[model samples]
Target: MNGALLTTWRLWDKIYYRCTRLCYVDQQNNNIFRVVIKKYGGKPLRSEQEVVVSPGDYYVKLHIHNCQLAHRLAGMTGEMRLGLAALKEVKTSLPALAKFVAEHPNADKITGVVGTTILYRGAQPLGFFVRDIDSPLVRWYKTFFFKLILSLCHPEGVARIYQKSDKLVAKRVFMSKRDLLERYLDDQPQT
Candidate 1:
């Protein structure tokens, strides 16, 4: 029974990856948006809205941050399931976020999530939290040791920790950004 469940999960995982990768974007400047017409073996899948991004105009979507704590703390089954989804989302998103930040280094007016913290940059610092850096050890970790270890492991990345901050600098930024995000969502036209 356990083996059957494992096999089913693996099959779903394969299907999920294949279905998700159906859409591809071409970055070449000369190409006028090429879309591949793939034929599925059986029933056709419904297509979502198509988006074309121009240079310097890209979308940065912010999903709710759900760490292991968030999943563990969820009391309801639905919440737990959503948290699990969030876990997967964060994993897939972090790499894409890193790639975007790398590709668009000088991107003017680049958008980002107002609520969350940025945990890594392309390999200077190892990890960071935005809320509180009251501890000297955390400061040391963010400043020195983390980067050293990261450089030893992988030098190409500039890892930066943007965890929640109680520090004077981040406090003001987070408060204002979060408020702006909330206001924007509030002002959206109702359906």
Candidate 2:
């Protein structure tokens, strides 16, 4: 999070956000996720709730703002503390995401939300269904990209990745529309 690094991150974030049209679920710089509505391209997936997401279905893809996350988590010590903080940030964003989907023009067409992450161990508890990436190429690409981001953002840097490589494999997480609404939305209508 040094001046130069921050500048690079800002530039990258700007480019990525524009190219992907990722909409912020909360305050621009402070939010943990940037999302885009996309058609599911991979094999069909079924959540624990028996919600089946098929190819060509429209869904929201959650993109973690890693640099922003790193900046927030910088200098935080201990795995437990970092994990808890990250989890808390995700929990906070759920309501906003629920609102976004509920208010979207294609709200009825959207089936659910999807995201890929290496940090998926705690996802099921949060109501996400974790699934292995079907394509080996995609799996490799995601793993490399996630680890690179981790190395760049983590306090321990490359050392942490080297030590924990095995546990860092990437996984896709799904939360169906029904699950998302049931978990994060209140009876009050979304504005």
Candidate 3:
């Protein structure tokens, strides 16, 4: 409960002022320069002054940000998978988890995945979305495409404001999880 409250507060803070500063070595001038990247309402400021990072600096900052995002996403996905795995023993487990995975077979789906990862034994992991993934060509396509999307979202990546749809989807997922827990915990088995 307390943790959730704190996360909410921190998220509010992060979104309200999603600013990132990157320090780069200006090769020509041999001087260190700072680039301020601000994402307002999940949109990067387009004005010249707003985006000062050079091509090299842009990559540097983007790479760093992307690395951070990947690490965080992996940690979260693993934790969610393990945590939900643990909950399997609970007789009243979440069923939506299985469906959610079916709809989104990739890690990003689960990581963007703000909802929950429930346990399931009666179903499979990779849904139709990634069932045949046998040939190298197909596999490469899937991997690279997901990575590209992740990169685009990296600079903003929840650090900035969320769109209305994003917020609603997240809320729906959370409510479903909450309802599942409540129903299972409180519902009396039909006698």
Best by lDDT: 2
Find the 10 residues in a row with the least total lDDT in model 1. Answer: 168-177
Model 1, stretches more than 4 Å misplaced? 1-77, 105-114, 117-128, 132-191
lDDT of 3 by residue, 1-191 (tens): 13453456456535533554443222232221222222222112122223322222211111122222232333333334533533332222223232222333341212111111111222122110102233456445644544443433333433322422122111001122223233333433343
The window of 10 residues in a row where model 2 has the poorest summed lDDT is 182-191
Better of 1 and 2 by TM-score: 2
What overall lDDT goes with each candidate model?
Answer: 0.30, 0.84, 0.28
Ranking by TM-score: 2, 1, 3
Tens-digit per-residue lDDT, 1-191, candidate 2: 35677679878988987887788877653668888999988888886557557999999998888877887887788888998998887877787788788998999999989999998988888889999998999999999999988887777878989998989999999889888888887733344
Q: How many residue pairs clash in each candidate?
A: 18, 0, 1
lDDT (10s digit) by residue, model 1, range 90-185:
433333333333344433343332222222221112111124334556455554533432222221223312221222121100112222243333
lDDT: which is higher, 1 or 2? 2
Model 1 residue 176 lDDT score: 21
Model 2 lDDT at residue 9: 82
**Better structure of 1 and 3 per lDDT:** 1
Stretches off by above 4 angstroms in model 2 are 187-191
